[model samples]
Target chain A: MKRYNEKDTVEMRQVYADTLLELATLDPKVVVLEADLSSAITTTKIKNQLKDRYVNVGIMEAEMIGAAAGLAVAGFKPFIHTFANFATRRVYDQVFLSLAYAKLDAVILGSDAGVTAEHNGGTHMPFEDLSLMRIIPEVTVYEASDATMLAALLKQGYKQPGLTYIRTIRKQAITLYDTSELFETGSKTLRKGTDAAILASGIMVAEALAAAEELAAQDIDVSVVDMYQIKPIDEDAVMEAAETGAIVTAENHNVIGGLGSAVAEVLAEKKPTKMYRIGIREKFGQVGTADWLKQDYGLTKIDIVKAVKHLCSE
Target chain B: MAVHQVKDLSLFAQEIRYYTLKQFVTMGFGHYGGSLSVVETLAVLYGKHLNSTPENKTDPERDYFVLSKGHAGPALYATLFLRGFIAKEWLQTLNQNNTRLPSHPDRNLTPGVDMTTGSLGQGISAATGIALGNRLARRDNWTYVIVGDGELNEGQVWEAVQMASHNKLDHLMVFVDDNKMQLDGPTKDISEPHDYVEKFKSFGCYSKRVDGKSTEAIDQAIEWGKKNKGKPTVIVLDTIKGQGVHVIEAMSNNHHLRPDEETTKKIMRECEALGERIGVST
Candidate 1:
């Protein structure tokens, strides 16, 4: 029942940059490290304004993570930024040993998750970053559905202890929450219905909402929930959604270890329901627009609608 | 803090090595090559330079130490024990299940173990970050990290190196235990990261190559590193893979050993003889 839009308003990367700058100004302990992708990640403002507080560690994701851990060890909160794929996979060991195992307070901003890598192609697309981060013990894994959610999640990441990974998207996200509404560290209901529910995250959230709108016309009242916090997943909201008895999980990632898998696991365990998944199959990404990539990977609104229909029929 | 005599430093280094070897026997298996190579370095650190103590464990401005080549956890455990940073009861607990001293240095699990390191190259990067943080916090402290030469093969090490130079992390000092051996084989045969001193220089760090066995040389490097500010320092310690007891040093590969009952008895005997040679207070 919030105001919905269909055009690009503002990029999430800019929101990330502004939020970091604001945090730096608020807390002296907040130091940030960039892996030489500041311009691409759009953190130049923080770099320029907070010169002494910022470090550009070149194109080294693992080293950036290591230094972040060190900063945390030395009693300063550190935030590291890089692309999503490199952030989660390439430096996984460092993130594990240096940050998590060390039990340090640090935040990693892994920009460009899933097909949001757009034209950057397969090597850059991080369809499994969520799964990789979720596997780390005590790491608070998060993905933002829109700019508002990202700003609030980042603020929480700054004060939060232990290693935290914020899976960020560089492109503009369809606005999901209102200006007054803030993001919690769990899943939240976006549109309430009773026939079936769509548990979605990241870019798939808008698709899920669109599908909810389409299903409304068919008298199939579908609930759309934004399951943003992936690791410490909102089981309460999940059980609430499962009350409908039919569920469809959607995301811009592979079904193996992403939103689909996470929801499937919880639903199978807590409350068994007839469920369907709408996401990228076991395939790599390619050069295409975000919308095209969604359609190509069978992650569009149509896919969500189909899955919800199937769940309702079953 | 009393300045320990060089003789005391040498004696402490020998005792620490002896303790590590016995711990190996107790634990059944351990990293020997990397541990022995960094004995003198760890000794010079805990025994002389590091302003650390049993009571001052939580001191914020205390000099920080990071063992980047973390397989050498036993050596550090022995040194921490001798330095009063940890209890002697935990010395023989190396690699034991649920023991505070695991195979790798864990910061939270153990007292005075500054950084949790086992994955190579991360510790140095952490030290660099600590150094930068020290400057930002206006905390007067030096951050020392011991990294194996083979561990330098990790690309992240080079990345940290460049960032350290760029950030002017002058309070950070790195000791490269150039034992020339790694998990697979000789570092040259495995993957040669040729000329570390030159590599450090290229990365804009002040570097030196010194005999790792000589405590005086390590002391001098520390003195120089402290005086030279505006850039980080790297002391490349030229060392043998196994250098403590003659028997272990002579073996073709002493990096790790499974001490069967036969080998365990031989090592215990060697520890006794080495103890006597160093004048263990009997």
Candidate 2:
């Protein structure tokens, strides 16, 4: 077992920029598009290096998507970036029709995932981005759990065909995977037990690990699995966890159509295990720190600990 | 540029009108007005300008055409059929169940559709992106798109326009089908579109308005646009909704007509008249 580290390493945005620069430098067909948020995602640092391959479409998310479709038509693989809310909710029809419906190849990186919007508040926070993306046919949706995972997913997203949407946070996250770790399997189990399984993603993976450690102190043995790819979810790992007879899903998004819902759908059809979903429920976000918001939304380690205990006991 | 070439293009325009009406009549009811409005432009494009044929239509390096006002797909499909990009039999399948030819253009389903567009104001943006991509790749392939005047109401059209002009995508050309009618009513009654030429010029395009029903004027405007460098071009096409058919043109609401017995008869008569002009049978 790889012990969890609480220390934050490199910012996810930096990893995104570095990986994009590496990919763009290697492939002429790779194009990067930003909707006036180049500085926000640190893509502006590579502007001179990428030259014509980098395009900033100036506050037009819909136009960016349309252009990406066009670029895809002309044999260019486009990587488009914008805030999660703007990328999904603001220009959903464009993403749906121009990119996905047109069968064009493009990867959309939606930074500042739910709760991470922090001071940007409810208007910028997207609890439904996963829901919006998951509904689109053949669109591979992923939530990056850490810096190395973000880099790995970005590289994979570049080579894959069809439409892909990756939800990520722009700031530093708790270090999980090392640089050598690969995310090709879509998930990784950090801890193992038979009492129950704590299935989590993104920021919640760290919390789930912490909860598992705390539960271990009390002699309640539970497992923690990082389910990164939300759409083509790791159903095999899910069923494996379902063997424990108890499961608790945790995420930073709304419970309605995100990780919790995805896992519940698989379990409902396959195994029918006892489960509890811990995430934002029937609420909007506001101006607050990410830590405070996670506590308010019941998305902390304690919340996962409570849900795991309740589900296991029941 | 020759007199006989313009005459041949004029006959091609009539052929496009003929096939467009054939598809609409086959579908029972379709976007006849908007479809008819862009016949001459489609003829001019397929017959003379576009560097694409049935064999090379799938080639990525070939010139691209995106019908932004995708309700006018029948016009494009008719042009593609005449150009041999699609079989004549596929013309009967427009909007039918499990048909490749939907009500709008679909790139994957239809043989010659460069972009799928039904939701208005999106095709133009895709066209601009294609143009930019071609420019970056140093390909001489040109990207052309058509947008309805009513479709201009979507802010995304302007966003694409701004990006196209900013990028100086000289190989890109836009055609605004100023048919002056929308689904609800006249465009003027719905939204006051002040002046397309001036608006496009302000957005950094070399724009010109021409008689949309005339193949010669459209061909000449495209020539002028091709000569202009350092910017994309917008050709504002001044045309009637049900262009080339007097009875349909005179109708107050011909945008999407569910014709009565008499109206269907009249439309079929006009179709026969067009086929006669083009030396083809309806």
Candidate 3:
């Protein structure tokens, strides 16, 4: 097991800014587009560093996506960032036709997923963003586990073609891995054990890991995998995990059409793994801090521990 | 400076009508009412003005034509076929199951299509983006977009208007096909805003009202739009729905009513005679 360090204690938003800034420097064609919330989203830092490449289209989400499509047509790679709720819902038409349907290469960074925007209330919390974006045929969806994963994912997003939605969070998350480890797009098994397999993504990966550690003390060895890329899921890894008979799914999004559903889609077809979902139930979140929201939604280390126990009992 | 002789404009209008009828009949029937309304403007834009090629479809530096009122794709599709951007055979498969020419003009599926637009008011916003992009890149290629007068009901259309005016995107030219009809009923019955010309002028656009059927006026509008460099231009084309076919024009719901067999024959007869008059084949 790898020991986590304080060096990985960077905020995902700050990592997102740093990664985009580095990407802009590395590829002259890379451009950043913000929807008036650049400073709030912390992408203004990247804009400040890469002045010529960053574009701040004030408060016009639809127009920003449209302009990004045009920029993509003109041989420039554009990265658009805004709140997760607005990115998928408000400007869906523009993102659908202008980017996805047109097959234009653009990246939309959606921050604050699943009650991450605590005091901002339900309107700000993007509980169903994953479902909205995953419906688009060509979209590649990613939810980062930590700062390092976000940095790596943003780098990968810059190099990738077609539409990809990065479901970014606004808080500093615990580091799950070091930079030396390789991260695949679809599925990557982080822990290998015999009792059952734990499939988790985004902020839930850390909880899943902690739960795995607790379950191991009880003589139940559990496997942990980071299912980062939701669409075009790693079918092979899922099948391998299901071969062990016990399986559990988790994410920072709603249970429906998110990571759990994505895994279930493959498992139902290939191997029937006894699965349990650990996520926000079919309910909207209320105003609260990030820690309180996570606890209220059963998205904690204790929740994961209980879920693993239930799967074992079944 | 190029003047389109009325005879040539009449011929182009007949050709556009012919293709539109063919596409409508092939697809069983689509937004024929809206499609029929924009025939004159589509004729002028694709026939006499826009610089494009059927072969070099992906050329980055070429001028762009976006159909913001994309429900009227049949008119645009007919124009594309006439311009040789797509093979004439492709028209037969329009709106068919798994056809390249779906109800909307998908840029990925169709050649010479600048953007895929079906949702009203989005096409102009995309064209605004293209103009802004061209300006930023310092490219000479201008962008042109056509909107149904009824499509102005969408608020995004005005958002595009403000952006175009504020950015001073002179390379952009917009033609509002003021045929005065939409999905439900007439634009006046549904939600008639203000005088679009004055609305655009107040929004900072260089505005004009033109007899859309006259190719000479359309060409002049194009030249004026090109010569003016600080503000965007909107040419309000006062056209009639089903203008070439008199019977269809007389119908209350010209938007999507299929002409009877006799009416179809009459349209065919009119196109055939017009073709002969212009010395062109259908």
> Which candidate number has the best TM-score?
2
Off by over 4 Å in 1: A1-3, A6-9, B1-7, B277-282
Q: Could you give the CAPRI-style class of model 1?
A: high
Deviation in angstroms for A234 in model 1? 0.8
- Candidate 1, residues B235-279, lDDT tens digits: the string is 999998877767677777888888678867877888887688677
TM-scores for every candidate against the unseen true structure = 0.96, 0.98, 0.94
Candidate 3: clashing pairs of residues: B33-B255
Q: List the residue pairs that clash in candidate 2.
A: none
Q: What is candidate 2's CA lDDT for residue B281?
A: 72
- Residues B5-40 of candidate 3 have per-residue lDDT tens digits of 234765687778877877766555667667776787
Choose 1 or 3, whichever is better by DockQ: 1
- Global Cα lDDT for candidate 3: 0.81
Order of candidate numbers by DockQ, starting with the best: 2, 1, 3
- DockQ measured for candidate 3: 0.56
Top lDDT: which candidate number? 2
Best by DockQ: 2
Q: Which of the CAPRI classes, incorrect, acceptable, medium or high, describes model 3?
A: medium
A1-314, model 1: which lDDT tens digit per residue? Answer: 56456534779989888999999998888998888899987888668788788888877787789888888888889988899888888988988889988899988999998888988998899888888988889999888889888998998888778988999788788877776776764887889999999999988888888888888888989899999998888888888989999989998888888777888889889888889888778798898988789888998888888888877776
**Candidate 3: regions farther than 4 A off:** A5-7, B1-7, B26-28, B280-282
